[model samples]
Target: MKISARNTLKGTVKEIKEGVVNNEITIQLAGGQEIISIITQTSSNALGLKLGKAVTAVIKASNVMVAVED
Candidate 1:
């Protein structure tokens, strides 16, 4: 599939929190980093998301905030 977003990362499904209308999915990348995505329940079911399943996280945003402490 073609996408405009470039921030795609390979990860494995770590957790799935199902809701009535939406499902919250957590993916664990290499080195134990984790990312969470809230997607539609229909889409989640279509993808058949489950634990330990390999997936890719695509991040698209207009603004990303970062902070550092010294």
Candidate 2:
């Protein structure tokens, strides 16, 4: 999945933690650093986020957001 963010970290997905009813998936990096990313509200195809899968985690600042009008 190509996500547009500030930075990207190339790593393997080590594990997945899913709740009882479509909970968020917590992807663990190869280096043992776990990052919790929300599965998009519209994504329901089950992209099979599994272990040992090569993936990229987009890193961005939390304080970056603003509202605008057209």
Candidate 3:
């Protein structure tokens, strides 16, 4: 898979929450960090995402925002 995204983290599928139109995927990184992504149900099924499966989290964005409680 060749793409323009440079921030790719390899991890294992930790959990999957299937919804009506989308599915939430949780990936656990080597350092114990977890990243969650929500994708379309169709795409999720096509990728065959499952628990314990090795996968890569591709991160591509123009802007990333951080938040804090006031």
Candidate 4:
């Protein structure tokens, strides 16, 4: 898949949390980092995401904010 998103990380599906309207996907990167994404149930089913399945996490955002403990 090709898109304008530059931030793409290769990882494997670690866990899947099914919800009524959406599904939570957890991907574990090579460096042991985990990224979670929430997508529509239909989209999740269409992609066929499953445990141990290889996938890519694409990140596209207009602005990213960071906050620290006060």
The per-model lDDT (C-alpha) reads: 0.91, 0.62, 0.91, 0.91
Better of 1 and 4 by TM-score: 1
lDDT of 1 by residue, 1-70 (tens): 7998768889999999999999999999997999999999999999999999999998766545677998
Which pairs of residues clash in candidate 4, taking residues 3 or more apart in a chain or in different chains? Answer: none
Which candidate model has the greater TM-score, 1 or 2?
A: 1
Per-residue accuracy of model 3 over 1-70 as CA lDDT, tens digit each: 5998767899999999999999999999999999999999898899988999999998775445678999
Off by over 4 Å in 2: 1-4, 20-34, 40-45, 62-70
**Of 2 and 4, the candidate ranking higher by lDDT:** 4
Candidates sorted on TM-score, descending? 1, 4, 3, 2
User: Pairing residues by index, what is the TM-score of model 2?
Assistant: 0.51
RMSD of each: 1.4, 7.7, 2.2, 1.8
lDDT of 2 by residue, 1-70 (tens): 6655677667766556565555454656667787666664334125656777677767775645778997
Write one digit per residue (lDDT tens) for candidate 4, span 1-70: 5798768899999999999999999999999999999999899899999999999998875534578999
Q: Which consecutive 10 residues in model 3 have the weakest lDDT in total?
A: 58-67
